[model samples]
Structures are given as C-alpha cells and as structure tokens.
Target: MSTAVATRSGARRIRLDVRLLVLALVMAGAVGYLMYTGLQGTAASYFVTVSELQARASEVDGRRVRVGGDVVTGSIVRGGPGEPIHFRIGDGTSELEVVYSGVLPDIFAEGRHVIVEGLYRNGQPVQADSVLTQCPSRFEAAPTASSS
Candidate 1:
C-alpha cells in the first residue's frame, strides 16, 4: 500500500510540471504576437520637405507619404466653393504641384507652411487625404491706410 501511494504522488507531480510548462509557452507566444503586431501597425514613414521628396520620389512612390513645404506664392487656385485645392509647394530649389480634394485648413493660403499627405505616382503629385497648414503670427500692427 505504501509503495502504491508513493507512485501515485510521483505521477501527480509529473502532470503538474507538464501543465506549468505548457502554460508558460502559451503566455510567451501571446506576448510575442502582441509585440509583432504592435510594431507592424505603428510602422510608418514621416514628413519630409519637397526637395527631399523629389530626390526620393522613386523610392517613396506608391507608398504612404508626407511632404512639407512653403506654399508657392501665386500658385494657389481655389476651385468652386468647396472643390479640390490646387497649389504648388516649394523648398527653395524646386516645387511640387499638389492637388488635394479635401477641405483646406482655415489658415491654408499662399506662402503658408503646409504639410501634404499623399502618394506620388508617375512623378505627378497625387491628391492627399489630409492637409496641415501653419500660419505665421500677425500680432504686430502693420501700417494701415488710416495710420499711413
């Protein structure tokens, strides 16, 4: 009877050890999968200037892109009341023509800082889904007609 009880206890210990090992393996796999998916989802390119984008257009085409530059003066054409915006963005040396079919920001005007998010296809600027405009401060008073 004593020998039989000892054998049963040893078998229970082995079963418990196997269960713990399997549980640990499952937890590790879950953690690894979460990490891999998180990294994949957050992997994205960043904003760049028009000149840099032009140089890397071959490599960046057909992928998600963000281009930032100053809006070229005299290049803004407002179509209709709420139609697509057409403008040119430049980085001192070169300019990129851009067409964005979304509502422009309130501060989106000629000579403003703009960041366009879209893809460049076949060396042409594709329309972007989003546009960001950063306007310069105008707190200082300019000489108005009354003052002048």
Candidate 2:
C-alpha cells in the first residue's frame, strides 16, 4: 500500500509540472505576438540624403526609404489636382528625381526642403507616396532697434 501511494503522488506531481510548463509557453507566445504587432504598427523611418541614397542605390533598389533634400529650383512641375507632380530634390552634391500624386501641402513649393517617402529603383525616379515639407524655424523676423 505504501508503494502504491508513493507512485500515485509522484505521477500527480509530474502531470502538474507538465501543465505548468505548457501554460508558461502559451503565455510567452502571447507576449511575443503582442510585441511584434505593436512594433509593426508604429515603425518609424529615418531620412537619407540624395547623395547617400544614390551612393547606396544598388543595395536599396526597390526598397522603401525617406529621402530628404532641398527641392531644386525650376524643377517643380505641378499638375492639376489628382495628377502627378514631378520634381527634383538635391543634397548639394546629387539630385534625385521624384514623382508624387496626391494633395500637396499648402506650404509645398519649389526651393523648400522636403522629405519624400516611397519606393526607390536604381536609375529611375522615386515613386513617392508622401511628400513632407520642412517648415522654417523662424516664423517671424527678429525685432530690429530703430536708429536714434
């Protein structure tokens, strides 16, 4: 009788340990899944200059990127609403052609710095899905002292 009771207790302990391990694994999986989804939803992109983008064009071909540069003068060709807007952005040393089709911001214009987000293919213009213009830090001019 003593041997039978000892065997039964040991079996129960083993079953309980197995159940606890399975529960822990399930909880870990749930936490991992939540983290992955949370990060994917709020992923942020960093800016790359036109020169940097061109230098690495081969490696980043067809990949999504955000390119920042000043819009080249006389390079903005605005189309009617809902049409494609063509422009070139240059980072002093290099230029990247861009094409965007959407409602442009009110402040968007030639000569303003812009950040374009889209797919880039080597030897081709960037097909931009979004264009964001950089606003100037000084909205008002500094007050000057009048000569006495």
Candidate 3:
C-alpha cells in the first residue's frame, strides 16, 4: 500500500513538470513571432542607392524604396504653382533624376544630403512623396561677443 501511494505521487509530479515545460515553449514562440513581424514591417521599406536600384530595376521597380544621396549641384528646378519640383540626386559616381510634389523641408536645398522615399519604375525618375534632409553638422554658429 505504501509503495502504490508513493508511485502515484511521483507520476503526478512528472505530469506537472511536463505541462510547465510545454507552456514555456509556447510563450517563447509567440513572443518570437511577434518580434519577427514587427521588424518585417520596417525592413520592407529597404534602402538602396541609385546604382544599386539600377542594377536591380526588375526586382524593385514599382515598389516603394528609399534612396539616400546628395542633391546634385544645379540639378534642382522649382516649378510654378502646383507643379512638381525636379532634381537630380547622386552618389558621386552616379546620379538619378527625381520628381517630388510635396512641401519640401525647410532645410532642403541643392548640395544637401537627402533621403527620398518614393516609387521607382525602371528607366524613369523616382516619383518622390517625401524628401528628408540631413541635419547640418553645426546646428548654429557660435555667437560673437558683439552679437551676444
């Protein structure tokens, strides 16, 4: 009778341990899945340069992408009311033409480093929906004693 009672108790403890292990595995899997999906949303908007896109046009055409480059000198052309602004962005060795229609950032100008997000089609200028300029290395000039 004593042996039988001890065996039953041992079996019950084993079952409880198994259940706890299974629960922990399920929780870990759920958390990992959530993190993967969150990162996918951001990674989908991949970043590439003009040359990189040109090399893989068929793969990225018509898809939204981000291209970072400097505004090519003398490539900026402002349009009349309601017209799109045209410009060329380059990575020194190569360049791409872009057309953007939106409120340009106050800091946007020729020769500034910018990141353009828009749709890209093979052999055509990007239809940019947004333009972002890099913050200047010096946010403000040091005030002279007279100015202060």
Candidate 4:
C-alpha cells in the first residue's frame, strides 16, 4: 500500500509540471506577437525632399512618404467650395504635382514651404493625405536695435 501511494504522488507531480510548461509557452508567444505588432505600428514614414523623391522614384513609388518643398508660384489651383485643390511643389531643380482634397490651411499659399504626406503614384500625381506648412518665423527672435 505504501508503494502504491508513492507512485500516485509522482504521477500527479509530473502532470502539474507539464501543465506549467504549456502555460509558459503560451504566455511567451503572446508577448512576442504584441512586440511585433507594436513595432509595425511605430514604423516611421520616409521623409525626403522633392529632388530626392525624384531620384528615388522607382524605389518609392506607391509608398507612403513625406516630401518637403516650396509650393511653385502660379501653380495653385483651387476648385469650388468643396472641391479638391491641385498644386505643384518644387525643390529648385525638380518638381512634383500634388493633389489634395481637404480644406486648405490659412497659411497655405503659393511660394510657401510645405510638407506633403501621401502616396506617390507612378506616372501620375501624388495623392496627398495631408498638407503641412511651416510658420515663416516661429524660431526667429525680433530684431533688437544696437545701442551704440
């Protein structure tokens, strides 16, 4: 009888150990999946200038990116009250056409520096999701008169 009791206890211990091991594996897998998804969500979008985008056109086509350039003078065309606006952006030697269907910022205008976030369509124009304009003098301090 004593030998029988010892055998049963050993069996129970083995079962408990197996259960614990399975639980640990499941928890580890869950943690790994969470980490992978977090990293994917936090991936940074590519940022480039108009000229750089032109140089890498083949590589960046159809990918979401942020391009910075000056709005070309005489290129802004506003549609009716609720229509999309079309414009051209340029970086000195290169240029890109952009189409955005959103309300224009009060500061958005021709010749202003702007950053456009969107997908570049091959052989077409940039399908802009958002447009951002920089303040002309946000970091500049007021000029001070020199006291001789």
Candidate 5:
C-alpha cells in the first residue's frame, strides 16, 4: 500500500509539470505575436535621390517617402493658394517635379539642394507634403559682368 501511494504522488507531480510547461509556451507565443505586429505597423522604406528614385520608382509608388536632389535651373513655377510652389529636382539621369502648398523655407530656390516628402501617382511628379531647401549664404558675392 505504501509503494502504491508513492507512485500516485509521483504521477501527479509529473502532470503538474507538464501543465506548467504548456502555460509557459502559450505565454511566449502571445508575446512573440505582439512583437511581430508592432514591428509591422511601423515599417517604412527611406527615400532616395532623383536617380535612385527613378530606378526604384515602381516599387516606391503609393508608399511614404522622402526624396532629395538638386533643384533644376529652369523648372521653378510658383502658383497661388492651394498650389504654392512647383519645381523639378534632378540628379543628372532623371528629374522629378514637386508641388508644395505650405510656406517655403527662406533658402528654397533654383539650383539649391531640396528634399521633398510625398507619394507619386502614375508617371507624373509626386505631390509633396513637406519641402526643405538648402540655400546659399547671404554673405556670398555674385560675379560682376565683364564689359566687352
């Protein structure tokens, strides 16, 4: 009788250990799922320059992005109200037109460094939600015209 009771107690202990292991596995799985969802929600790709953008345009469209390039010499066009500014950004190989509605930075100008953030539709230029320009210094001197 004593031997039988000892065996029963040992079996009960083994069953309890198995239940605890299952609970641990369930908890770990739940934590892993939450982590995966959180990472997916915040995933995004970084933007590139005009050349890089053109190369990856198909894959980048409809996704959030930030692109930067030099402003083209003769592509700036200012509009009114809803359409504040329009300009083309270039990286030699390709160019992209950007439309910005909000107030522009003081340094925003032609032939300057610009970074525009937005989405592209079809083959047309991407409309920008934000535009940043790198302007030249005011202390810089302009070249004087030479008389012939």
Candidate 6:
C-alpha cells in the first residue's frame, strides 16, 4: 500500500540523517584532537633561568625544559668525531653542565648567550636535544654622553 511504502521511506531518511550526524560529530572530534596534539608539539617549552632550574632540580629532572645562560668560558670540550660535545652554561651565580650530540650552531662559543632545550639528568647535567645561540652584536651599542 502507498501508506506503508511512505512510512518505510520516512524511516529510512531519518536513519540516514542520524548516521550523518554521528559521522559529522566523529569527524569533528578527530579534527579537534589532531589540532590539540599539533599545537602541543609546536608549543615552546617554558624558559627557565640557570638558577631557577637549579633550584627546581628535583621537580624538573627527567622533564623537558628550556634553559638560558651564558656559556662558561674554558668549559667546552670537543670529543672525537661522532662524540657528544660537553660544556657548561651559567648565570652569574649558578651553572649546569650540558651534553649535546648534535651539530653546534655556527655562532656557538664561550661566553655567548645560549638556550638549551632538553632534559635534566642526575640532578646536574642537561642532556640537550637542541642548542640555540644569540648573536653578540644583535643589540645596539649603548648611547654615550657627549662631552660639553
């Protein structure tokens, strides 16, 4: 009968609409999850000073962190080919040893401002995954007072 056929057709449409709605919600959730994870991956790690990092050694050990300090002069030791580079980074009053196994930046050197991102191990040394350096001349020279 025409009435019976129309009833079945309406039910089918309703079922299809429900399925589509569920699918849309699932897709949206997947996209949201991907975006959240992607942003997390690209987020910058929290920057910590050498002294702060030292003070929080127990809380931060084995966790990823970013530390900024000047490279300690006379502390860089280059190993044989393919070996890790060892150095010390310090604030004026606190310092930590860093061991890196990657290629050093061209401007990396002693007494330079550097940021190392990695994990702190054994409550002392940082096992650096990346090393960044700031150009010494990037800032303008201080203005001098003219003699009267």
lDDT by residue (28-127, candidate 3, tens digit) is: 9999999999999988666777778778889998898799899999999999999999999998878999999999999998899999999999889999
lDDT of 6 by residue, 1-148 (tens): 9999999999999999999999999999999999999888777655789999989888887898899999999999999999999999999999899999999999999999999999887566899999999887757899899999
lDDT (Cα, 0-100) at 70 in candidate 6: 98
Q: List the residue pairs that clash in candidate 4.
A: none
Question: Residue 135 of candidate 6: its Cα lDDT?
Answer: 81
lDDT of 5 by residue, 1-148 (tens): 9999999999999999999999999999999999999887666334488888777878987776788888899898988677668889998778888877888888887788888988776487787888877667788999899999
lDDT of 1 by residue, 109-148 (tens): 8888988888687577757888888866778678668654
Model 3 sits at a Cα RMSD from the real structure of 4.3
Candidate 5 lDDT score at position 19:
100
> What's the lDDT for candidate 4?
0.90
RMSD for each of the candidates: 4.7, 3.7, 4.3, 3.8, 6.8, 3.6
Least lDDT summed over 10 consecutive residues: which range in candidate 1?
40-49
Q: Ten-residue segment with the worst summed lDDT in candidate 4?
A: 39-48
* TM-score list, all predictions: 0.67, 0.69, 0.72, 0.67, 0.60, 0.72
Each model's total of backbone clashes: 0, 0, 0, 0, 0, 0
Q: Report the poorest 10 consecutive residues by lDDT, candidate 5.
A: 40-49
Query: Which lDDT values do the candidates have, in the order given?
Result: 0.85, 0.92, 0.91, 0.90, 0.83, 0.92
3 or 6, greater by lDDT: 6
* Candidate 4 residue lDDT tens string, 107-131: 9999999999988977788999899
In model 4, the runs with Cα more than 4 Å from the true position are 62-66, 69-75, 90-93, 104-115, 132-140, 143-148
Please list the residue runs of candidate 5 whose C-alpha ends up more than 4 Å from where it truly belongs after superposition.
1-47, 135-148
